[model samples]
Target: MPTVRVTRYVTPLREGGSLPGVVEAEDLGTYVCKFRGAGQGPRVLVAEVIVAGLARLLEIPTPDQVVLDVDPEIARYEADEEVQDLLNASAGLNLGIDFLPGAFGYDPISEPARDLAGRVLWLDALTANVDRSWRNPNLLVWRGVLYAIDHGASLYFHHSWPGGTGDPVRFAAQPYDASEHILRGYAAEARDQDVVLGKRLDDDALRSVLAEVCDDWLEPVPGAEDADALRERYVAFLRARLDGDRGWLPGEGAA
Candidate 1:
């Protein structure tokens, strides 16, 4: 992977969305970063970086995300009052990710749906991702290839955590289907091989990948007081997930 220096923090693209920073990439592409010291905490941006890095390790088609330093003076939220309000409510959210420019759609319930669903199921089990749904599949269809995106809502279990209060929304139960459907026109051999579908996502491999990529991003920022502790917490949480008793792997899902 090539390193891209986030030398400047241009004006944030304050469109209506979850993350705050709308930045200009360095000859790469436009990115929507979670600015550091933004609303909530550095944890949000850090989590995004960690998730994307780990997903790549799991062989998932995830967009590249990285930290970019910007002089606070150059940073300005968009002019829209509602956007600013959203920004104000959530400040210090700059961390950029290249937004792929293209058009794609999911062919669910069709032949290709099985492969797509399998990849998605593996993604959910690995990261414990909970956002994919009938409304927000989060999987994209860019040029006919399935690409995963928007994982900020996963690790934290922002909706329900530390307690089994409600049902786990496995993104429309894509992980539990029996027939294993795929793209209608795909060859039988290809479908039988299940190559487009991923495995359980080796837990040890996942941890190693996370530990490697997150080292730089884990460094404490100048402003955030709890940055170090937060980073450590995230790493430890990931370590536990990779080696814990979650019983989320493949056939282990039935256990």
Candidate 2:
């Protein structure tokens, strides 16, 4: 919603064995820049910008984030070649995310899996993030609720946009059926003021939020394929969920 400027480029942090640069944002506070090497890899910053911003609009619990212009001259950390190679080989070339010093870390939820169903459904339906599984523990439990992080791996099926028409992913538009676990979990947290959870998305809100956050980035990166195909796929996915039939609470929402 507000213009973000990258300022005070901080040293990089090694997470998942890659060097991700951290920068202080004059308006948004802090951000982690996933470095892009010469080789090919999914653009983590673009994913963050689209997914995190959209997640916020969908009322999902995501860490506040923004895209940052990186300064190679100011880069204070040297990446370990072996680690970089490994991440490059396994996770591809982009550097991992740079988080802030006070960013809170928490244990995963310990209750029945049902509590996380709504979250999983939201991640699947909207961001289409593939990382937040029970095994990966990408969802962090702080205080008493869940917060989502590490979305560097989603929308990978379509890497680049194709001249703006966009890729069509049928799953994007399908209604994400709430599992019994999701229904119970959302109901349990319905009264919890501190918890930021995803209620089912309606079509208009879903499209509006996606356009607001990702429309600009839908263009292809230089030297990369047009990103419009991917953008279309993402939009279609959101549309399917909104238009499809799904059970949702009356007024639960997040930002």
Number of the top-ranking candidate, with lDDT as the measure: 1
- For residue 200, model 2's alpha carbon misses the true position, in angstroms, by 5.7
What range of 10 consecutive residues in model 1 has the weakest lDDT sum? 176-185
Displacement of the residue 199 alpha carbon in candidate 2, Å: 8.2
- What is the clash count for each candidate, in the order shown? 23, 15
Name the lDDT of candidate 2: 0.47
Candidate lDDT (C-alpha), each: 0.49, 0.47
| Highest-TM-score candidate | 1
RMSD of each: 7.6, 7.6
Candidate 1, 1-255: lDDT as tens digits:
333444343455443245465556565556766654455455455556666776675456777765554444333434555445544444332466766677454546534444444555554554556566545566677766677776665565322322322223332222322122222123232234333332333445545545533344444433323445434444545544544443443342221
